[model samples]
Each structure stands twice: as C-alpha cells, then as structure tokens.
Target: MTLEKTPPASADPSPPSASSLAWARRRGSVARFWKEYRTHRAGLLGLAGLAFIALIALFAPLLVGGDVQSVTNAPGTALEKPSGEFPLGTDQFGRSLLGLLIWGARISLTVGLLAAALSVAIGTLVGVIAGHYGGWFATVVMRITDWFLVMPTLVLAIVLATVMSRSIWTVILAIGVTSWPTTARLVRAQTIAVESRPYIERARALGGGHGHIMTRHVLPNVMPLVLAQTTLGISSAILTEATLAFLGLGDPLIISWGGMLQDAREAGAVSSGHWWYLAPPGIAIAFVALAFTLCGRAIEAVLNPKLGVAR
Candidate 1:
C-alpha cells in the first residue's frame, strides 16, 4: 500500500483563527438579538419614536435656529396662540412651546440616561459582590437593599432632590441614588442563580479568583437583565423628573416639559382653554414614557420567555 506522505506538523491545517471565531460568535449573537427584537412590532415603533425624538433634540439649534432663548422666551409674544410664526403657540413666559419642547427633550433624555447608567453601575457592583462572595457580605448587601426597597423610592428621591441644588445633575443624582435598590435586588437574584451553575463551579475549581469569575462569567450572563432594567429605568426617571418640575422643585434656569406644564397650570391655561399650551407638553411626556415602556417590555420578553405573550 502506498502511504501518502504525512504533512509536516507545521503544514497541518490550522483550526479557524481565534479572531475569526470571535467575529462569527459576535455576528451570530447580534443576529439572534435582532431576530428576537423584531418579533415585537410595538418595540420597533417605540424605537423609531425614540430615534425621532433624539434626532430632534440633537439638531434643535439647526432646526429652529440657534437662538434658543429668543425662540423660547419672546417677552412680547407670551401666550401667542398658534399662528404662522409659532406652530405650537407660546407659553405664559412668551417662550415658543415648540422650542421649549425641543430643548426639554435633551434635558429629559440626558437625565434619564445618566440616572439609569449610575443606578445600573451601583446596582451591578453591589449585586455581583454580594452574590459572588455570599455569607455575611451577601446578608449585609441584601439587608441594605431591603431597607431601600421598603422605603418609598419617589419620596426618597424627592427628599434628596430637595436637599441638593436645583440642577440637572442634582436631579440625576437623586433619581439614581433612590432607584438603585430595585436593580440591586434584581441583579443579586440573577447573580445567585448564575453562581449556582455548573460552569461557575468549574471556574472556581480551576482556581478562578472572585474578580475573574464575576467579571468573566457572572456579569455576561446577567447583562441582559441589567439592560432591560436600564431601559425601564429611563422612563421612571423621566416621570420622576417631571413630577419634581411640576412641584416647582426643578432648576429655575432650565426649560423642560414638566416646567412647561407648571407654567401652563400657573397661567390658568387649562381653565382658559388654551389646549395648545397644555396638550403639547402633556402629550410629549406621555408618548415618551410609552415609547420607553414598549421597548423595555420587548426586551424583557426577549430575555425572559415567560414574559413573552403575543402583543
């Protein structure tokens, strides 16, 4: 039998390169996520609405001219009914309701994003540490979380907001600090479940340190839940900010949707039947909240199949 010459070890066919394998995995993950995401029509619509709002906020100066103060606070044109010059009408301050709405989007979205990010970071860190280590650390963390949970989040946020300077950053800090307990509890539960998996045990057996296992293993698994929570948290933060603004606790210098509402109420727009003044801001707030809610629900459904109902 003629034996074919064996290829030298150096000439042996290499398995797929690590980079290629990683690329393939990433592509597959993205595709799978999109597939799941697209199944919800409401989610797609919500995403579209959110994108539209974000774009408007980003290009507010270009769209409405760079003179925000002039457009928003035209002293002579205060409460001008919708006309050719002002489409959404002017508020009690003579500020173009449209300009206020546009700029307000930037403020609301910024506060929501910053607060959600801060809350998620704190929650994830506490949860991972508590879950990974367990024992006394876990007990202490859980107890602290419970105490926060038992306290009314909105009330606590209001108190914090009251104590701090009336600024966007203060609002963000108040909301983030008050909001993290729920996320911590959620993350902690998920972490505990992930920690009990066989892969986690194997990693521990292989002499993986707490940091290594938590970062490399536990975090990846819990990320979907965290992401879903973050999306939902945005809506909550926005609503909370609106409440504060309506209650006259918001920064006096900034114009926001809630501030618009507050101005409208003070101007007796509701009683005076200036539908344009009250309706625009109220509708904007509701629609924005609804959009976030839809997106968050879709994410939750994708991550947790039990929550996926035909909708």
Candidate 2:
C-alpha cells in the first residue's frame, strides 16, 4: 500500500478568524431575530406606524413649506376653521394645528427615545452589578431599587419635574430616574439565571474576569428583555411627559401634543365644540401609545415563550 504523505501540522487549515466568527455570530443573531419578529402581524403594523411618525417628524419643516413661524404664529389666521388655506385649522395662537402636531411629534419622540436610553443604561448597570457580585452590594442595590419600585412612578416623575426647571431635559431626566426600577428587577432576574449557566461557570473556571464575562456573555443574553422593556418604556415616558405638560409643567418654549391639549382646554375648545383643536393631538397621543404597546407585546411574546403560549 502506498502511504500518502501526511500534511505537516504547520500546513493544517487555520480556524476562522476572530473577526469573521464575530461577524457570522452577529449576522445569525439578526437573522434569527428578524425571523421571530416577522411572524407577528401586530408588530409589523406597529413598526410601520412608528416609521411613518418618524418620517413626518423628520420632514416637518419641508412639509410646512419652511415657514415655521407662519405656521406657529399666524395671528391673522386665529381660530379659522379647517379650510383650503389651512387644512388642520389654526389654534388659539393662530398657529397651524397641522404644523404644531408635526412639530410636537418630534419633541415627543425625542423625549421618549432619550428617557428610554437613560433608564435602560441605569437599570442595566445596577442589575449587572447586583447580580454579578451577589453579596452586600447586591443587597444594597436591591434595597434601593425596591424603594424606587414602591413609589408611584408618575407621582415621583411629576414631583421631580416640578423640582427641576421646566424643560425637555428636565422631563427626560425625571422620567428616566423614576422608570428604571422595573427594568433593574427584570435584568437582575435574567442576569442571575445567565450567571448560573454552565458556560458561565466554565468561563469563571478559565479565569475570566467579571467585567469581561459580564459584558461579553451575560449582557448579550439579557438584551432581548432590555429591548422589550425599552419599547414599553418609550410609551410610558411619552405619556408621563404629556401628563406633566397637561398639568402645565412642560417646557414653555416647545410645542407638544399635550401642550396643545392644554391650550385647547384653556381656550374652551372642547366646551365650544371646536373638534378640530381637540381631536388631532388626542388622537395622535393615543395612536402612538397604542403602536408602542402593540410592538412591546409582540417583542415580549417573542422573547418569553411562556407568554406566547399563554396568549
């Protein structure tokens, strides 16, 4: 028998490069997530609605013909009913209701996004630390989280907003600070579960550092839950800001859907049967909230199989 010369060890094929492996992993993750997400019809609709709203906000100036002041302060057009000249009619300030609605969408979306990001960041840090350490640190962190949890979020947010300057940043901060406890609890529970996995134990045995393991391993596993919570958080943050604005605590310099509602109420639009003033903003808020709720539910269903089964 002729023996074929064996290839030297140095000539052995190399394993995939680290960068290629990482790219493949990320591509797989995104593909899997999209597969799951596409199965839910309501999620798709909600996503479409959100995208439409974002587009309107992005092109508000162009849509309004770049005359923001004319739309926002047309004193000559005050209280005009919907007509060919102004489709959505003018507010008490003679500003185009359509213009105000478009602009308000921008503010509401911005605050929602910022507040959700801040809340998620704080919650993730607290949860990761508490779950990873699991000692006096965990006890202290959980206690603080519980303290915030027991308080009514809206009431706490209102109080915080009142204490700070009435500005967009103030509203964003107030909502974020008050909104993190639930996320912290969720992340902590998920982290604990992930930490107990055999792979994590193997990592620890291999002398993996806490920061490295947590960031590289634990955080990725917990991110689906974080994403679901973030969608819900955006809706809640928007509603909370609206509540504050309706109560006359919103930034005076900015127009918002809630501020429009407040102005309509103060101007007796509802009592005077001016449906044009009251309907658009209320509908906008309700529509946006419903969209977020639908999307969040769909995400939860995908991430938590139990919920899907129950549904």
Candidate 3:
C-alpha cells in the first residue's frame, strides 16, 4: 500500500505579475520618500505649523462667531492688548485679532494656492510647448519668457492689479500672470532634458505622436520640478499678496494680514507704539513664508535625493 501511494502532482506557483510588482515598487518608493522627508526637522516643523494654521482657518466658523468681524458690534476695544477674553487683542475696528488672523489665513492661503496654480499651469504649458516643439516656436516663447523674467515681477503684478478691478480675483490674476516666468524657464529646461532621453526616442520610434509623448512621458518626468516650483511659488504669492494689500490694491471688504498692516500704518501704530497691532500680522506673514519655504526645501530634498545628500 505504501509503495502504491504516490505524492499528488503539484503545480509550480507563478511569480508576482508585472503590474503587481510595479505597484509594490511604487508603494516602496513612497514609503522611502516619507522616511527620508521625516528626517528634515525644519520641514516637519513647518509642515506641522502649516497644518495647525490650516486647521484654524478651516474651523474658523466653529472657533469664532461671525460677529467677530462686525465693526458696529465689536466685542472688544480698539487696539486692546492680548487678554484672556480676546487673545491677540483687537484691531482698529475692535475686531478680534485671533478671529481676524484665522479668517485672514483663509484668504491668504487661498490666494497663494490659486495664484501659484495658475502661474504653474501657464508656465508648464509655455515651457512644454516651447521645449517639445523647439526651433522658431521655442525662440519666440523664450523671448517672451525672457521679457517677463527681466522685468521686476512685483512691478508687473502692481501694474496689472492697478489696471484690473479691485477684487480678490483681480489680485489672484495679477499675481498669476506676473510670477510665471521663473517657472517657465525651469520647466523648459527640464522638458528639454526629458525630451532628449533615450526612452523618449524609443517612444517616438514606437509611433507615439507629440501629444502622446509629451503627455505620457515628458509630463511625468518634469512633474517633480513643477511640484517643487509650485510649493516655492506659494510663498512668493503670499508675500506678493501682502505687498499688494499693503499698497492699497487688496479688497477693502476683507480681513487679511496685509490689510491689518495697512490699518496699523494708517493708524500711526509705529508712532503710537501699538506693537500689538503691528506685530501679530507681521509675525503671521513671516511665519507663513518660512513654513512654505521649509516645506518646499523638504519636497526638493525628497524628489532629488542627491540634493538631500548635498545638504
């Protein structure tokens, strides 16, 4: 009986499928990126701070009543110092500074994100078209980019804002149009490099059209640069928004850090030593700028490990 019994035939198990392996590789890459990014203390701190600020902005309605912005029924005295009842004190109109700061964060962050997105979109389009379809087209595009690059971004933005209607969208559009040249130059260089790769040539040989190649290959390759540029651009956009507001180009109906500063100046905060009025907004602006810069640096480090090593 023992001799007659034979082991049942077994089939060999197949290895992981190509798609599964690829998915696993992507997951591993993301994990590695997170691990590496966590090592950046400044970046982590900045990210945490940004998260806190964003939460405050997101929960502003729940945190503070709408009456906080009311000039007629203000809950505190104008320029009151920080107190338990009204932490961070009140603005010239007796509005709660804490509430104003939180509300202002929504506007500031919105402008920064929207303006940077618009700038990046325009820049990426210009850069890819210029780089992919080189020669005369590229020359013209580069000339345009150069013209924008050479001009002071602030001046251009100021001019645009001055001509446009005085509104939030106007500020966003002004900043968007004026701040794109730098991103254009960067993306163009990266796109050119990507287009010259052997894979791109192979893709061309495989009957891929310009649109297919650019969308499938070139865009993915240059996305890292675009992402980094966008993060960095947000900080610049926020600063610009503040500048525009301070210069009286911002919407007059909203509470913004820059508007706060402008009010402080108009109220002679400097001479009166209303440090409470000036310091909060100034610090808020600086804090946001530093946070974005730090996060941008970390994203760069993650995308280019060599950069992290160099640092």
**Backbone clashes in each candidate structure, one number apiece?**
2, 0, 0
Q: Per-residue error at 297 for model 3, in Å? A: 0.8
Task: Tell me the tens digit of each residue's lDDT in model 1 across 1-311.
Answer: 89899867777677999899989998999899889889999889989999999999898878765566554447446688998778888876677778878988888888888988998889988888888889987998899999998999889988988888899888899888888988888898999999999999899999999889999999999999999999998998888888888888888788788877888889999899999999998898899999998999888888888975555
> What is candidate 2's lDDT per residue for 143-262, written digit by digit as tens?
999999999998999899889998999999998998899999999999999999999999999999999889999999999999999999899888888888888888977888888888
lDDT of 1: 0.87
TM-score, predicted candidate 2 vs. hidden true structure: 0.91
Instruction: Give the winner by lDDT.
Output: 3
Put down candidate 3 lDDT per residue, 30-91, tens digits, no spaces. Answer: 89888988998888988998999899888888888666677999887788888998778887
Note the Cα lDDT for every prediction shown: 0.87, 0.88, 0.89
Arranged by lDDT with the best first, the candidates are 3, 2, 1
Show where candidate 1 strays beyond 4 Å. Answer: 1-16, 71-76
Candidate 2, position 89, lDDT: 90
